[model samples]
Target: MTTTLTTPTTTGPSRARRVAALARGETRLLLRNRTAVVNSVLLPLLLVAAVPAMDLGGDVPLGPQLLSTAVGVTLVFLTYYNLVSTYVARREDLVLQRMRTGELTAPEVLLGTAVPSLLISLGQVVVVAVGVAVLGEWSAPVEYLLPLVAVLLGTAVMTVLAAASTLFTRTPESAQITTLPLMVATTSLSGLLYPISSFPDWLSTVARLLPVTPVIELLQLGLAGRTWDGEVVDAGGAWAAAPLPLAVLAGWLVIGGVAARGFRWAPRR
Candidate 1:
């Protein structure tokens, strides 16, 4: 008599289980990395607090400027830097590749990885907003709620952009170099250091076209109770100083989506 051996089949983890596992692992990794933790959390808080004291020497209220500055820093540290570093580390370690082979879809893996960072950012925003409101006497109008939406949308766009950028990054060390262009360009053009309105006409025109411009405008408008009067005109002239936050953000979303589709989880063969 001949006996045949049966191979056992393994089932993948549930969606919830996979997400939880991914989040836990990512959190642990983030905690162990001292520089990542400091850059992601501590530096942003310091910048937010420090900006209010800076001598802009302008008539603008410190509250509004601080709010805008805080938002910019949050986006940079939480979304852009965090995503780039995390993606690079995961890619180099084959975590992304392993996740892709599991039950988790590409979108699921990306979203799952971003969940922890998103939570951290949301918490930071709450703390900063409360502190500013109490210390800076900030009183935003109800209609200004739109800027919060812009922040959320912008963060999502940046997260996807980070993932797309990682396709070109081979290791975590290279992420620092690859991220410089985006960090510098966005920080300068996004009104982090100074208001774009103060820039030269030509420079302001270029700033408006950048990805972070609309978000900053939205935040400033919300915080300052300013109206969009069509003063700033883009090359297309379609935005026209309007609350084009949704439109501009949607454009970035589309670009990021296309890039994500083209992104590779593993090194090219």
Candidate 2:
């Protein structure tokens, strides 16, 4: 008679515990990067300080514009660009791949990686609110839900886009270069740093095509209380009336999701 021996598999930490642990570790690493903290957290606050000086007599109030721009930079720096570098580093170091082979589901892995960034992003939002209130009168947005929606949607979109961006990013070092194009486009053209309403119709039309424009516009609507009466100013501000509100943002999220499906999870051999 022949007997067969079987080995039982052991489970890892509970889902909540696993995610929390990953987030704690990731947060530590994230904080250890002093340059990241300074650039992502401090620089945006500095920009907020400068926003007041750049008002230059606009229809949009300086307070709302400054607050919106400040918050927008936080989202980009903490959520979007930060994730690109984080994901690339993790993937290169095989952290992501190892997690994939464990008890962590793909969603869990993604959530774990994003936990630190999201927390930092949320904290910065509060800081912006309080700082703006302290510096100037803080009137809540007329469309309150829109700003929250903008933050939620923007965070999700940027997270997915960051993952997708890793497909072409060979190493963590090259992330800055690959990320620069989108960063510049979104910060400059998506109405994050300035109002697209102030732009020419032709320029606004082009800016609206950018993935981040809808989120930025929603942010302006939410944080800056900016709403156009579908009235186009010059030839460049057509983006003000574009069909890129929630619909456009959702579309970009889908695009990012699709793009991430093709990502290489392991470092190239």
Candidate 3:
């Protein structure tokens, strides 16, 4: 009998599938880390709760300010700090190095590792938004798209910045120290805890350029439909208010990406 030649076809998981699988695994690991879980889950809500207690002393509406604080804190501590620790831990364990030799590409590996944190941050922000609407008696956002765009781009910016942070973090424990500068800058200068409007004009201008400031600004504008200077804007006006912050975020994405290019996947010498 003549034998016919046969070819085999191989199929692999899609990029989304791959990332999801990695994210699931990461979630399991993250759950085991009590500190990470507490920080990611509890700290942000607590901080947001504390926001109303602060003598915020401003004309800005409390509801939108609370929402912005929740999102900014989540992005900072949950996504950015947690990802920095995860990246360093994975690199130290050679997990990143081994993954690099597999079918997963560099960007895939980074994004996959970051997926859990990103998802958690987004979910928490949604929860906070609902809480703001219900318990805080907040109205629906006039410019929903601005806050949505802010959160999406803000996540991307934080992810890249997290990857960049790992370049300085030698170990997971060291992430606390290495993460501080951005943390300080974001919390203090980004107007998350204070109004940039209260700053001197030049300082206010500079604060607007910080990485997380635009995201907070966008959220404020979207939720309150009011600019920093107390100008009321309709939905269409929100689009006009977006270009500067969007450009600033885009610029930071570039800066963070360039820095992350030098990230070490292997254990440090």
Candidate 4:
């Protein structure tokens, strides 16, 4: 008679516990990088501080514009760009590979690594909102849910985009170059700083498809109850107009998700 021996399965920490532990470690590393501290945290806030100085002119409300721009800045610099550097650094250091060899799920690993950046992004949102309220005399958002949704979805999109971006970035330093195209496009063409309507018709149509454009568009509608072309919208109309931009964001999320699935945990040979 032949007998087979089986090994029992063992469970480790809960997903939340595991992720939190990783986040704590990453937060410490992030704080140690003074350049990242300034670039990822300070620079975006500084840019948001400058938003109010823009001569946007006419009926364009400074409050919505400022808040929307702040959201975009947070998404780009604080979340997306910072995460690209983090992922690349960790991958090169073999941290991601070592983590994957353990009990942590891939999602948990990525999410944990992303926790600090996400927190900073959310904190900046609060800071910007309060600044607009107290200083800019900004009224509360017309449909608060829409702007909230915009930020949440935008964060997810940026997170995945950052992961996908690592495919081309061989090192942490090269991340700056690899990330520049999307950064520039989102800032310049996504209507974060300037209105997309100001672009020529074809260019505006193209710009509308960018990952961050829908985010800014959603914020504009939610905060100001105004459509992208400056049309005043009621609460109902604001939500009604949401599906198109939401679909656009969803598309980018799907695309980024696919690309990120191919992300390499180990450094290139």
Best by TM-score: 4
CA lDDT for candidate 1? 0.68
Model 1, 1-269: lDDT tens digits are: 11111222334456567777788877887788787666666754675567546764334467766666677776776777778777777766778788776767676677778877877776677767776776755765424565677687788888878877877777777888888898898898777676666788889877776777777777656555443322422222322344466678788888887777766666544
What lDDT does candidate 4 reach at residue 217?
86
The number of the candidate with the highest lDDT is 4
Off by over 4 Å in 2: 1-14, 56-58, 228-243
Q: What tens digits encode model 2's per-residue C-alpha lDDT throughout 1-269?
A: 11111222334557678889899999899889898677667765776566556763335556666666665676676687778888888888889888777777665677788898888878777776777777774765655667677778878888888888887888878988998898898888777655676789999888876767776666556545555322313212333433467787788889998887776667876
Between candidates 1 and 3, name the one with more favorable TM-score: 3
Candidate 4 C-alpha lDDT tens digits along 1-269:
11111222334557778889999999898789788677655654675567657655424588888778788988998799989999999999999889887887777888999999998888888877777776755977789899989999999999999989988899999998999999999999887767888889999899999999999989989989988888889889999999989999999999998888888888987
Residue pairs with colliding backbones in model 2 are: 200-236, 200-237, 201-235, 201-236, 201-237, 202-235, 202-236, 204-236
On lDDT, the stronger of 2 and 4 is: 4
Q: Rate the local accuracy (lDDT) of all candidates.
A: 0.68, 0.71, 0.81, 0.84
TM-score of 4: 0.91
Give the 10-residue window scoring lowest on summed lDDT in candidate 1. Answer: 1-10
Worst 10 residues of 4 by lDDT: 1-10
Clashing pairs in 3: none
Candidate 2 local Cα displacement, residue 108, angstroms: 1.4
**What overall lDDT, based on C-alpha atoms, would model 4 receive against the true structure?**
0.84
Query: 70-168 in candidate 3: lDDT tens per residue?
Result: 888888888899899999999999998888767666777888899888888887887777666656648788887899899999999999899888877
**By TM-score, how accurate is candidate 3?**
0.90
Q: Which stretches of candidate 4 lie over 4 Å from their true place?
A: 1-13, 39-41, 44-52
